[model samples]
Structures are given as C-alpha cells and as structure tokens.
Target: MGSLSVLLKESWSFVERPDRLAENFYARMFLADPALRDLFPITMDVQRSRLLQAIVHAVQTVDDPEAFGAYLGALGRDHRKFHVLPEQYITVGRCLIAALREACSTQWTIAHEQAWQDAYAAISVKMITAAAADRDNPPYWHAEVVKHERRTPDIAVLTVRPLQPYPYRAGQYVSVECQYHPRLWRVFSIANAPRADGLMQFHVRAVGAGFVSSALVWKAKPGDMLRLGAPIGTMSLDRTSTRDVVCVAGGTGLAPLKSLIEELATFNRTRWVHLFFGVRSRADLYDLGALNQLAGRHSWLSVVPSLSEDPGAPGCEQGTAAEVVARRGPWQEHDFFVSGSPAMVRSTLSTLSVLGIPRQRIRYDTLTSTVTGA
Candidate 1:
C-alpha cells in the first residue's frame, strides 16, 4: 500500500490537467457502458470536477484506512439515489485505470496497474459493504413543498412535508433534489428544529453558478415535490453537556446554527448561548428579525448581526463574524458551533484556535454532494 500510494502520487504529477483526466475516464466509462450515462446530469462540468476531486482525495487518504473507509461508505450511501450497483464499481475501476494509463503514458507501469487494481478492489468492497448494510433504509424521501418564501432575491426559505417520516437531528443537512432539475442535487441545512408533523425547513442561497439552488430559490413553488436524501452530518448539539455555547454563522450558515439554538431552547438548563450572524452587507441580513424575536423570548440566548463589508449598518456590528467573535473572545469555556460558506467556517475555526479554544470544543459539518459524516 505504501508503494501504491507513492506510485499514484508520482503518476499524478504527469497529468497536467485533472479535468482532462476526468473527461477521459468518463468518456471511456460511457463508451464501455452506455447505460451509465443516463445516471448523470446534462452538464458534466461539476461532475467532472467531483470525479477528479474524489480520485485525489482517495489517493491522498489511502494510507489512513479508517478515514478512507468512512469516505467510501458515505460515498456509497450517497450514490444509492443513482441506483449504483456493485457491478458498476468494476466498470468504473476499469475506466479509471485506463484513464490513468493514458494520462501517465510512458510513466505508467505494470506495478502501477496492479496497485491501482488492489486499491480499487479495497475501495469497492468497503463501499459495497456499507451500501449492503444500509439496504433497509430508504434511499431518499419525497417531500412536498407546503410553503416557499423568497426572503431575499437570492435566498429562499422552504417548508416541506415529507411523505414519510424523516428523522434528523438539529444542525444536520440533507441533499435536496428538485423536480425542475431532475438529476441535480444540492445540499442545504435544515433551518429549524424538528416538528411533530414531520415538517422540514431548508434555507437556500442561490450562488451564481448554482443550478439547483437557483431553481429552488427562484422557481420552486408551493405544491412542488422534491427529494431529500437520508440525513447525514456531525454538527448536532452535544446533549451530554450543558456548556455555554457560542454560534458563529455566516450568510446561509445561520440555518444549522439556528436549528441548534432552537433545540437548546427546549432544554431546562441555564447554559448561555451567543449567536453572531455575519453577512457581507446589511441588505444580506435576511433572518435578523426572526432571530431577534427568538432572542427576546429566550433570555439564555443572544443574537448579534454583523456586517463584514458594510460598516455603517444602523444596528449591526462592523466586521466579519470571526473578527467580531475575536473581539469578544477568549471563549475557552464555551462550545463553539460555526457554519456557513467553507471560507467562513475555516476562518472562524482559526479564530477559535487563536482564542485558546480546544479543537474538541468546536462543532461543524462540511456539506458536499456527499455529506462528510466527520
């Protein structure tokens, strides 16, 4: 395995364009098995990038069996929606090997082929084992949009009722598949705590090139049906402790943090919670009104809306959420929950570290096509 890792790392250097590598792999895959092509979206751009990213990640983590196995498991669970079968893994592996050989050309050797074969076999077994273990679970839940509100031009708040019981903890996110875009799915955090009626809420921000998000925010309407993947994430509240909590949310990242706060409100503890919601400008602050009302009702909670780029916002603090939290910190005693864009979360985590907060005290879930269960 050490030699296998080294070979892959060295061979990757010969492939100057990862996108071309992904393209070659997919092209060969579709040629070999035409039926597999239908499982993908019309636009292959994102899929290509994801393919290269997955391969790179797998190669990089091959030395860490536990992490690699978990990643493959999550990937397998996510692929259930595509109806991926164990046999398909063989096809993918063959195409992947061929692609690598073509990309590496003279650099490729029989030893490299043998190593990749072993690696792919191991990965496939792990993925198949995970999918088999999850056979009893529903691949996805069909939900009907009962309410859809465009809070801002690019942000939409949706309340959907699952056709069947969907159980998820606060701070978890689900991949949403809109009917308007059949094969495209995007991850969005559940914006509220669970309700007895099986109603789920999602807060979506339509990024410039976000196809699914654009459809959900701009075109989705009441009575439209959508599919929600099985709940997966690791940002839920730690019910074992009643520690003081500090939540730093940027943009739509507020969704999961708000859900966590709502869950805490139901508990009979005196632990204090401070929430700092950050946005680029005052106009981007969508949920401040509701957050303020919630804070007014809950004495244990405090909501601070911060403006990162706009300094003159009437009632908002001036700075990024991390910066604002830094000014107030030395929060060594508080459990921190940070969410939002990847950049925001990363920056906030750095700030927390600088303030002497232990890594174990921070909680966050990074969302992707396949949610990271870590």
Candidate 2:
C-alpha cells in the first residue's frame, strides 16, 4: 500500500489531461475486448469523469485498507446490475496501466507499472470476493411505476412496485434506469420506509440535460417500467442509539431524510427529531405540506423550513438551513443527518464540527457520481 501510494503520488504530475487518459483507457479496453463496449453507455462524457474520480478515490484510500475494502465491496455490489465478471477486472487493469503509461510517456517507469499492477490485483480480489458473496441476491429489481405525481415543474414523486421483494433500509439510495434512456442510470433516494404492500417511492428533481431524471419526471407514465440497482448507502438511522436526532436537508435531499423520519414514526421511536428543510425560495419547497402534517401529528418531530432566497415567505426561517441551525445553537448532543448537494453537505458538516459535534455522530452519504446534470 505504501509503495503504491508513493508511485501514485509521483505519477500524478504526468496526468496532464485526465479526459484524454480516460479516453485512451476506454479505447484500449474496447480494443482488448470488444464485447465490453456494449456494457457502457453510448455517451462517454460523464463516464470519463466517473472513471477518473474512481481512480483518484482508490489511490487516496490505499493507505486505509478498511475504507478501500469497503469501497471495493460497494463497487462490486453496484456493478452487479451491469453484469461485471471477475475476469473483466484483468482487462480493465491492463487498460488502466496502458492508459497511465501512455499518459506518462517518457516519464513512465517499470516501478510505477509494478506498483499499479499490485494495487489493482489487491482491489480486484476484494471486489471479486464481495461480488461472489452477493451472488444469491438479485442483481437488479424490475419495478413498474404505479403512481407518478409532479410535485413541481422539475420534481416528480414516483411510486413503484417491484416484481420481487426489494429489501432496503431507510435512507438508502438506488440507481434507477428508465427505459427511455437505456444503459444510463441515475441515483435517487427512496422517500418512504418499507410498507407491507411492497411499494417503493422516489423523489427525482430534474436538472439541466439529466437524461434519467428528465425522462422520469416528464416522459414516464403510470405503466412505465424501470430497473433498480441493488440498494446502497450508509446514511441510515442508528436504531441502537437513544439520542435526539437533527436532520438537515436541502432541495431534493429531503427524500432520504423523510424516509428516516417515517421509519422512526413507524417504529414509535420517541426521540426528538429536528428536521430543517432548505430551499432557494418558497416555490421550491415542494414537500412542505407533507412535512408540516407529519410534524403536527408527532409531538417529538419539528420541521423547520428555511428559505435562503425568499426569507419573507410565511413560516419560513430566513437564511440557509445551516445558518438557521447555527442560530438554534447547542447541537453538540444530537445525532446529525445531513444531506444535499455536495456543497451544502460540506457546509453543514463544517458547521456541525464547529459546534463541537463528534464526527462519529454525524452521518451522511457521499454521492459517488453526479445525479443531477449540474
């Protein structure tokens, strides 16, 4: 791990154009195995970015074996829907090394290649082991949309029923593939807890040029069928803990938080919950009514809607959700769940740290890829 980390750091200077590197990598991969090309989406733009990000993540976590192993396990589980085989990892590793060598040009060394090969072998073993262990589980769930409601111009709440039992914890997210855009998947959090009827709900906010989100929000009908990847995420409620919970959500990030809250309600957990839903304006606050109704029914739950743009809106607290949370003060004792865009989550996390909150008590799911087009 140490040698691989050193090699990665030393080779970082040679990566002048990651886009070109990814392009070369894919070209080499396809050249090696033409059949692999069919597994990828038609558009390689976002896929290139994802590849680069994955490489960076793997390199940075090399020293932390536990984190790296967990990442590989999750990757293996997620790639099951794509039908990735253990043998394919060898091809990918070869292409990756070839891309790095080509990118490095004259600077590429035998030591660097050896380090990468060793690192990739270790990664592949963990991934393959995890995938084999998960063979019994279904790769993906075939679901039919039973209800679709446009909550806002760009946001749609969908109710889908899986043909088979789809078991997932509250606050977990799943990759959704709509028929309109084949091979393209977007991640969305389930909005509700598991019900006896086997109904699953998702809240999707369409951003500019989001293929899956746009198709789901606009083109998808009641009878539309969608493919759901294995559920993945760690932002679930800590049921063993008896501490009060503080949930901070921005825009569509409210979906998972709502699920956690509903799960608590269903379990009759009496812990106090402070939920702060933030939006740019009053018009963007789509689920305020539902949240308010939940809060009204549960004495232990408090819903605070914060408007950063339309502060004067009735019942809306002025400033960002993090700002409002700061004003409330003394949040060190609460277990925190923060969700939103990457920026929002980071900002809230920083605020929590400043308030003397322990890192272990803070929970959030870091998105591996971009869901929104932005």
Candidate 3:
C-alpha cells in the first residue's frame, strides 16, 4: 500500500463521526465563498453523506492506481453537472484541510496535515483532467416525460424522451435533476435497453425522506421536464460468458437487472436466467405483471417474486431475497447480479461469499441511489 493511503486509513479513526466532518467541511466551504453554496441542493442531508462517502472511497482505494484513477475520472465527469470551476478546486482543498484538522482534534500531527494536502492535490488533479478531457459531451440533457403510470401509492413507472438523442447502455445509470427538486441530482438506473426513439424508463418509489423520489412519484406528469447527467457504471452484460445467470433484486433494485435481461433476450440463444424479485409484501410487487409477461415470452427466463413480510401470500416465495437465493443456490458457476438498498446488497454479498461464489462473477451498481433506493 502507498504510504499516504496507510496514513489516511490510520487517520480515518479521527473521522468516526463522518457526518459531522462533512457538515464542518461544507460550512467552511460555503462560508469561505458563499457563491459555492448555489451548486448544492436545497437539502444538505444526502449531499453530506455523499461527500463523506466519496472521501472514504478515495481513502480506501488510493493504493490501487487503476481503479482509483478511473473512479476519480468518472466522478470528475459527473461533477460537470455542478458547473464546478478550476479555481474552486483550490478553495475546496483549503476547506477540506481545515475540516480534517478539526476532525483529527488535538491529536493531529504536522505529518498528518502534509499527507492530507498531498492526497488532496492528487485527487484534484485526476478529477480536473477528466472533466477537462470530456469536452464533447454536454453538461446535461433535457428530457420530457411522455408517459407516466402510478404503479402503487408510492411507486410510479415513468418514461421520458430526451429532447436530443441520449445514448446509454442498459445497466448504466445517470444522475437526474427534476424541476421540482431543481439542483438536487439523484441517480436512477435505466430500466430498459436503448431504443431508437431515445425514450428512457425509470421506476421510482417515494421514500420517506427522499425529496427527489417523492417528487417523481407523486408530482411528475407526462409533460414534466427533467435534466440528466452523463451515464456511468459497468454492470452491463458480459457477452463472453456462457454461464447461466441468477439475479436477486429487492424492491426496485429489479430495474438494472431487468434491463440486462432485456439486452440478453435480444441476442441470447442459450443460458437460462433465474430472477428472484423480493418485496415486503405482494402489494409492493409493483412490476410483477411486466416481469411475468417478459418471462412468458422468454422461454429461458424465470421470474420469482418473493414476499419478505408476507408468508401467507400464495404463488410467491416467503423470505428475504438473499435468504431465498441461498436456499436455492449452489450458484457457484452462474454469473450473479445483486442490487438493492445498502443493507440488502451487503446481506446478499455476504450470502454469496458463504456459498463460495467467486467475487469476479458478481456485478452490481450501487451508484444509482436516491435518498431512498432508486
């Protein structure tokens, strides 16, 4: 491991309360230059978490140059939507150092401060280069909803067509900024493979504290407009792999997997697919009808909707999706895809590890998340 990565990891103990550190950093940044505050959302809660998570991810992966550089590049490309400027990077670095010093309390050493400064410079360079190199792409795309259907009280299935052609792969996700939530951007996985019409589908369930999700589920109509950031993520199909697939989805996590299945259906001549779709109750099986139709049309595909909270529901499995998948596995050879809330994804990954599945065989996109699961 690089000496700086080790230093950052060791100093991580000082940030036991990352939320507070994030708050401190933002407060300092805005105070230092009030104009910068305009770049963030009205609600700072999710933004705080994302900021801390981004730092933590960088700290954790600093030793792996390839992965670390790619992550920073994509992150830089994504940050273009914020309209961040070159000079602002210098201001951010200063505020970040001030926040780190406070986070480390009196225990902070001169060596620690120097290491953090060096680290910040490296991070800023990678991000700036990536953003600068992406000169051909627009900062964002504007799309207007053409179809909207309420799937449940809190869930909605919506389709929108970009004003211009929007290109994206099935499993990738793009950050979206709706009119209702103006500056707030939340990522959502594209629910279908690319079509000639340039229409994109999103399945949203209004989460308790998720403002963007609530707006999309309850307020968005056919004529509503939204802004979309560039596509990111690598959870797409592996055409070279002939192994059958097992997909485990909890609630709306089914979005990306369904897209992959659609892509697979177009070209796959072999390889059976088993999908376990889990929800709290049958009422939450908002897309069951659509899933069933897909299964009916594709002989190699099977859809199992599991109810974690409803054991009495007929025609469905009764357990958490991970639990049911474990019971049915021996999935040692199949390529796997798991998606859901952080808790759900972690649980499923642990189950897969216990079942002895190889780490390389699994693919997922946790990047597409709203205040709630997106």
Candidate 4:
C-alpha cells in the first residue's frame, strides 16, 4: 500500500460509473462479511444510496488525492460502530479488490490490481487500529437507574448514574442491557450533559415492542443495575459560528440534539438557533418546557412544535417536520442538524438537499427508539 490516493484516483478515473463503483463497494463489502450484516436492517436501501452520494461528494471536493485520506479516517472511525473485527478485514479487502476489477475494464493490468489490493490493505490496517483502540479504551457504562421521572404515559426520563463516569460528548449514546433479558441491549443517547458530579441521564420513551424500553417502563426500578456498552454515534456540534443553526428532531430523536443545542445556548454562540420538533401528537412531544426555558434564557434560541397525526392538539403546527422546513424556504443559509428515526433523518436530509443546503453542513445519527418484546 504505497500510495492509496494514487490507486483510488486511478480507479476512480478508470471506472465508467463512479456511482456504481461506490455502491458496489458496499454491496461487495457486506456480501463478503456477513457477520456485519445486522448492523444494517433489510430495509436499508436508502442508507446504501446515501453512502454512494457521500462518496461522490467526497471525491469531487478533493483538491488533491492525498486530501481524501480524511475520508478513509472517518470511515475507519465509523466502522467501529459496527464492531468490525480485525481478522475479517482480509475478506473485506478481497471484496473491494474484486469490485474494483469489475468496475474497471479488463484493461486493469496485474500491476493495477495489485495496487488496488495494496491500497485496501493499508486502509484496512488503519481501520483495524482504530477498532482496537476503541475496544481497548471502552466508554464507561453504569446502568444504574438512580431516579425515574415519568414525563408522560409513554415517556420516562430516567436518571442513570454510571459506576464509572460516562465520558462522552453530549450527543453520543450508550447501549443499556435489559435486566429482564440481559442478551438484549438498547441504545439511548444522553438527554443532558454530564453534570459536575458525573451523573448521566437518558430520556427514554417506552415503545411497546422494545425490550429494554419495556423494562424501564414496567419492570426496572431505582437501584436496579444493568449492563451498558460504551458511547457511540456522531451528532455533535460543528465548528461553525457564522451560519444559522437549525435542529429538526422527531420523537425521541431529540435526545442527542438536546445536548447539542444546550451546549450552544451555554456558549451563547453567535449562530441563531431554531428547533423544529415533530411528533405524532402533543403527548408524544417531551421536554417542551425545557426547550421553552432554553429559548427564553437565550434570545437567539426559538422552538417550534409540529404534529403529523394530530395538528388539532393544544400546541402544535400542522404537518411533518419536512413539510415545515419546506414552508420555511431559503434554507441555504443554515447549518442543518437532524435526528430521530432513520426514516426521519433520511427524509429531513433529503428535504434539506433539495433546499440547496450542502450535505456536509448536516450532522445526524439514526439510532432510533425501539422496544424488545418477550
């Protein structure tokens, strides 16, 4: 793997359909590594589409071949979420080589094939190293339910205080094991930032099918302990103070973005903040007062509540979050932050894309709410 950039560039140019090449890379990667299959659901065609579009965007933005190295690094970091094993890299590497072979003509000489192999090997090494570091230094997970505040019939804000301090950027989530069924683990993003005392909290909504959510709602109690995985996901704040910041969240997707917006308010950043929250009904919405208080304390922050199912409710605008964004045109000037169900995140991103906001300006995570049933 002498020069991955050169190999990638050559492969990129030789391939007649760059989009197909990008898409095939993922297809082959998954086919060769079935162990990672559960990381994505059967209904992941849209996510597959986005990966190709993201790759195209990355390649087109590169000024020099070497500059694309960051894309590889980000990929390595992201692969950690799937818990990719080091030994399986060889299989993934082989699939990548085969895809490159198919995408490029038989014009690809042995030397070219070897170059592609070397490049994938190098990237695999980087990815493996990152995965190792993540395994070695796992995030603190204390699954102790210190306090439970039932916000509504379906939503409960559990104050989970970990045994070890949960050291994560506000917007990340931790996987909690179900006491009723230890094998089942559920991931919940932190609803609040780590306090000075080191307590971490989660605003969990009880979904009928979710095992962990049901345990929290009906079975789990204070002083009960459970297992939890290290923090993961990337829905953090970007380093931009110039653009207007708009956060769109649906249902429990607001958990992570809540921390991000609060951080922004704490700093009182120059970026004006607008939050568009959408739920099925008024009761489905949580923490409205917290957001309202945040808005009042920070003159720059404004919150809008939207309802998809029951617009006739006490305090909700009519329509889906995507429709609301569409009504508020000229979205080009804002940095878009979105979270919720994978569907919501995807829909919002698609809407923002059509509104002329660049994909790079949007940050989101798709770890949606689900319940485990017995």
Please list the Cα RMSD from the true structure of every candidate, rounded to 1 decimal place. Answer: 3.5, 2.5, 1.9, 6.9
**CA lDDT of 303 in candidate 4?**
87
Angstrom error of the Cα, residue 328, model 1: value is 1.4
Q: Considering lDDT, which of the candidate structures 1 and 2 is the better prediction for this target? A: 2
- 1 or 3, which is superior by TM-score? 3
- Per-residue C-alpha lDDT of model 3 across residues 166-191, encoded as one tens digit per residue: 87888877788899888988888788
User: What local lDDT score does residue 120 receive in model 3, on the 0 to 100 scale?
Assistant: 89
- Which tens-of-lDDT digit does each residue in 1-86 have in candidate 2? 68779998688678999899999999999999999999888987767877886788788778988778877787778789989878
Per-residue error (Å), model 4, residue 108:
16
Please identify which of the two predictions, 1 or 2, would achieve the higher TM-score against the true structure. 2
Error of 4 at 191 (Å): 1.5
Q: Which scores better on lDDT, 2 or 4?
A: 2
Error of 4 at 363 (Å): 1.2
Question: lDDT score of model 4?
Answer: 0.69
TM-score of each: 0.86, 0.91, 0.94, 0.68
Top candidate by TM-score: 3
| Model 4 per-residue lDDT tens digits across residues 1-374 | 23544555666678787567656877887777767667654444344544554445344434434434544444465455456677777876677667778888776768778766766665677656655665654433546788887777878777777777557777777666656755445567887766777676677777755656867866778998866665666667865557888889888778877888877766665788888998888877768988898888888888889999985877678888877988985778788888787678778888888888888788765434321111
What is the Cα root-mean-square deviation between model 2 and the actual structure? 2.5
Q: Name the 10 consecutive residues with the lowest summed lDDT in model 1.
A: 365-374
Candidate 4, run of 10 with poorest lDDT: 365-374
lDDT of 2: 0.86
